[model samples]
Target: MTKWSTIASSLSPDKMFLMKQAMEQLDTRYDEQESMVWGEEGQHDTRESAHYALGLLLRGSLEDVQMASGIIDRVLEMQLTQQGEIYEGTFRASPEQQAPPSGYTAWGTFSPGYGYAQQDALTEVYRRFAQYAQLEEQTQYKEQFGRAADEVFPRVWESFDPNWREFIACTFAVILENFEDRLSIKQVARMDKAMQRAVSTSLERYVSQSIPTNTNIELMHLFIAHYYGHRYEQIDWIQHAERGAMALLDDYRELHSFAEFNSSTYYGVDLTVLGMWRVYGRSVSFRNIGLQLEHGLWEDIAAFYSPAMENICGPFARSYENEITSHSSIGVLLYLALGESKRHLTSINCETSHDLLIALFGVDVPEAALQQLREQQGERFAVRQFKELCERDLPGHNRHVCTATAWLSPQLMIGGLTGSHNTNGQMHHATAHWLDEQGRRYSMRMVRREVGQSWNTHLRGMTFNVETEVSRLDITAHLEAAVPIELVFELEGAALHEIQITADRWQLPGLTVQVDAQAPQPQVIQQGGRAEIVYAVEHRDRIWNQMHFRLYFL
Candidate 1:
């Protein structure tokens, strides 16, 4: 028998029984209440198909392929009608029942959210499949892609739902454009620019009005419209999307905007960051026009499923600690980038709100957190976000993670460095790197602490920033504190000398200067003058306020 089979058999007599049970559930093919959330909009089966499909891609088991392929088949089979309109909403109900607007579908399962659609769900199916098809068999892969190129695009073109229709059509258009490029090359047929404009215009109108968006329905259309607008030089469409996206970020607060909420952070702050990402950080189209939104959108989409990443994708997402709510972590990350965190944000399952604060944009494990992930990963998937972190960046910046984009920071990446516990489960997410000015090196250690509570409720009250140069640095703290214990900073180096400290009168009481190996004592100095050493106590959580420093030659 194979190692997996032998191992399964040895580990538990019930392992085979469990697999059998899963197979039985597969046979029954009953969707859970949770699954219904996705399927209700004709989008469930496709996304599940995508999920299983991704698992299959990683493990590459034939059973996985068949399972994923069959799910995709079921979704395709349950088409609203061959007429390419009127879709199922998980219950297998007919069009007549959906039309009355009972204000509830499934007796209360769904809010008739984002309305109904036919092509949008299937287009998402196409999106997931396309990502999977790369590692898939070229023949069958090409065949499924061929269906998307041929049958799907035409149906998308005919659809009535604005968001899903536009999105699916755009997806199909992108495929056609790509197919022409990859399989057969001829002078590309020009798209109907007016039709494209219509797509983005509708979507932009929806977001501009702060109308319901971020569902399978709205996201699909929005994805298509924004992506293709840029592709075909549709400036007005881009401008329109930009304006609406900006409003969502600048004006909308989760506490104030009841509409700005979702099951996953991906739809809320994540998407907010995404829209912001597309605008400011410049997330470009990886493939077809619409998919720029998918990757960026999906990045936000999957934040809450960190638990799933634990259960499903393994260590790639294991870098997150148990204390941080996925939503909270997402909120903090966004605040680090956006300058404020939205309130009434829901907590992610298997996460607490405290964990969120520690998960800022540039935060990392401090030797203690890593051990926990390893123990968990060791038990399950042997996951390694370290490899991921080194390649991308810690805490997923404007780029997400290090590996997903580029190595973050002037700090050389943790090349080939992995995490394991030393008798105790203490973990560290940092590497020893030289902080230098033309090869002069000083060690910089980043640590995370959540010791004090801020009187201010805004997350801006809880955040701080520190930057290091050759011999000088600036520290900024955001707080509305009576006595914010600002983090104390100093250079305990051998080559360091003549480190002087100074601060404004208001900040003077918070200062205690301790030069190399000196005592931690308060010092008085004129504002704007250099100090031999600087000891500072920043009150917890504030933003955009800084203590300046001017270094002198020894």
Candidate 2:
């Protein structure tokens, strides 16, 4: 059997199902006339097209290969080739749009962050195209790929960020190790020069700075780079990587959690990078470490996942969206592990499509983790985890962070973090999920609001003392600054009789919330199919720094 088929045969039926479903989804997104995938917003995205091409290449039929080749040709044409320009080496964000020159500042705009084009999009194209050349039997495809490399390799030196630099270097290493015969002397020379630059720059950074553990996704990329550097006999890169990896492993050993703990989006990046190390690392020690970390990470994800609620219980350190149905990279892995019953609860979109690369390279999740996800029903459990935050400026001193007591029962799951130093406002410190009488899932969470600014929901320096029982939660929140806030209860699928409010309490279909602070009356705002019960907490006379509330599951 071919390598892809061999791996496919080894996958469990559920995983195979997930792979097939993902492929079909990609196929549906393809625009036959354009030879690319159109994003949800009706614009053509280069990275999304590259991911679709990779999926098609993996499917590996004659027609699929032809289509994938065409998509790749279109993607390569999108590269910005004007030398001396800021984005010269990067692909365009779209055919009509260039990345914002100011880098990450223009997020949520028509011209978005530079990383989408410069780092992530280019890396995806190069890695996926390299795999295509490796797997195709035809010599013409390999030659075309080599010429494409000639065009792209000279630009690798343009990437300066540690994570992006390492990503390009690792891809170059893979191409050199596997497809050296196809590359011309000029292409190889250019790639090696770029690779050396990345290595030397990385070595200097590692020597001068303490290795960071707080951003778990970027840490994995650095580890992968170190593994490749070691394989290619770069002594300093491997040394620092080994020391950093060992220290990170020690932290996980103590807490059974990551510093960037319980992130629904970034965990997928972590898992994929570990899988790459496990599959590609030549060193046995690195491979073993990857396996160990991957297994532990999977176990943590299983523990937090609620089968009844169809989502992971959070005190999410970072999350882009509140609902699993919106979009989650880890949701792809969960669907693979848990099977078709969860199909409706998970989402796969253009941005997360490249995560399918994990399946292309095999990832072996532990059987124990799989069992936990499958058998979580009718189980009542509680989890407490601790992690340390590295103060980048204050090297030696680390801040201790305690995750909230997560209580999971058959009908409900609730959790929060004791506190967070997250400045990006992605932290969901306290959240609850439960099913109503009609079996529709409902959610509630605490959010900070600036005085007179109801739309402001940035969570920063908020601390919580949260305790959970079988059907109740007691939460006391300490704000760093005195601010008006609200407990926003999402009532998406509720009927009129399912909600009732008294003076200081709220009665929902499945939950009763008792407020302890003097606050304004509750407001119910309806927007389309969704409604929110905004229970506001406002301080008038003096600056009260603390607020207390209780939740009882009915």
Candidate 3:
């Protein structure tokens, strides 16, 4: 096991300062919350906050540790109030007092959703707090911690859904291994029962043909089998786990990083879990393979880090907003905390946990890399490109798309194929943008297409070809159906200035023109440097099948 001292003394002064600042910022955020929510206000994810608290306790200062303890205690206290299925969360503020967040909350009004890490964290909180209470000679608090563990155990085990997430399963197995002996005799019996359930569920997931091909899930099943096989003395579990691990090794050899969306976050999550298996698994091969996977993932992720944005700049095949910091933080925690060797310690500032850096990744960054990062931070413009087949399963199988992402200093640009099969219609168009230093997004222009007749049914298998230059973007949309269509070009962003549009060879009768005879007249609506241009074309002609729109940003 790696000691915090080894990592601590080796950290650089500049890196140390940033880590401290991040930890202080996290502490201040929790302090401001009357009760902790998720990253944003009005929402709380059981797992997200739980993991945050785990990171805090593992790497936080004394005060931060105490603060995390209180947060976990509050969660345990909340868990105690439930009688039926274990609801994942509680609204710290009632709707009458503060409006509930719009759309579905994580578990939807405390429904017994997939327990995942929430259940694991609830148990972990009790386990950790009991240790703290014992250290302080607080018999009352120790009893309270134990009692809370018992209160949460049945709910966690009973509500467990095997089909949901593999990481949660890994957490569950670890918890049982660590704390099972400490429980009461009755609780031990309950733990045994839960183990049996996990084995059966895991087996089902392992052998199922229809399950998506995911590296993490596959490796997770192997780890679970290895752990429980020993506990239950089942030879079949061990054999299955070994086979599963070997299969993953083969896939990794071919794919390097296996197919998945949001490589930074998902890969980080998988690597952390693999680190757990490396520590827990008996087979040396599993650990060896895990380390190789770690190196590949780190190299890939580090390339995307833009010191200018202090975030993972993207041509992300599958992307989300808030996970950039969290994903990078998970990597720092796992690699520095557990890896045998501390090679290049790059991308330390990307994580938000100062304590994690000092305790896990290390307090010191390499002088040369640190200098380079600072130098890049001062530069005005930068551009990056990723030209590879990024395979994803969301829209379909073997779905790898060629995409490009560029960072023009404060501006970030991502361009790629539009999502044809997207049910939500969120990413149905080609988009590119740059974020100014203020974190405001500015796009040159965005083109969205709407087919008037049978649009929904006709959308299947459609494709868009986008050609882009330094100062211009041309989008040629192939809509095979001869249906009326409208192309909407929205120039959006806070940094947009002096917005103006002039279309050539296009007739504009208030932006209405026939699809065959003339290009639609561009209707420009401008307000404060943000403008929307609407073009309507509904003529029956073969040319309408291929509609082209060009825009220039000066």
* Maximum-lDDT candidate: 2
Q: Write the per-residue lDDT of candidate 3 for residues 230-292, one digit (tens) a residue.
A: 778888888887777776666556644454433454555566556666566767776666666
Ranking by TM-score: 2, 3, 1
lDDT of 3 at 101: 22
Compute the lDDT of residue 131 as modeled in candidate 1.
Answer: 61
Whole-model lDDT values for every prediction: 0.30, 0.59, 0.44
For residues 1-554, what per-residue lDDT tens digits would candidate 1 score against the true structure?
A: 32222223343222233233323333343344322213234444332332233223222345544453444334333223222122222112212122211212221222222222223344446546756666553234645654544343322223223333333243233333323332222212322333353464455335432123433344434445456666677776666555544443332332222121222322333333233233322224312222344243333223212221121121112232212234333433332222222222223332221221122112222233323322332111111221111111112211111111112123221111122111111111221122234433332221122223321111112232323233222333332332233333212223343334434211112122222321224343222322122333432342323333222111
lDDT of 2: 0.59
Candidate 2, residues 293-399: lDDT per residue as tens digits?
98999888888888767678866765665566555667666665666776664456533564546565545689988887787656566575766453322334445
For each candidate, give its TM-score against the true structure. 0.27, 0.71, 0.51
lDDT of residue 422 for candidate 1: 12
Off by over 4 Å in 2: 1-17, 27-49, 61-214, 230-233, 322-325, 339-347, 350-352, 377-379, 388-398, 449-461, 480-498, 535-545
By descending lDDT, how would the candidates be arranged? 2, 3, 1
| Poorest lDDT segment (10 consecutive residues) of candidate 1 | 420-429
Angstrom error at residue 127, model 2:
43
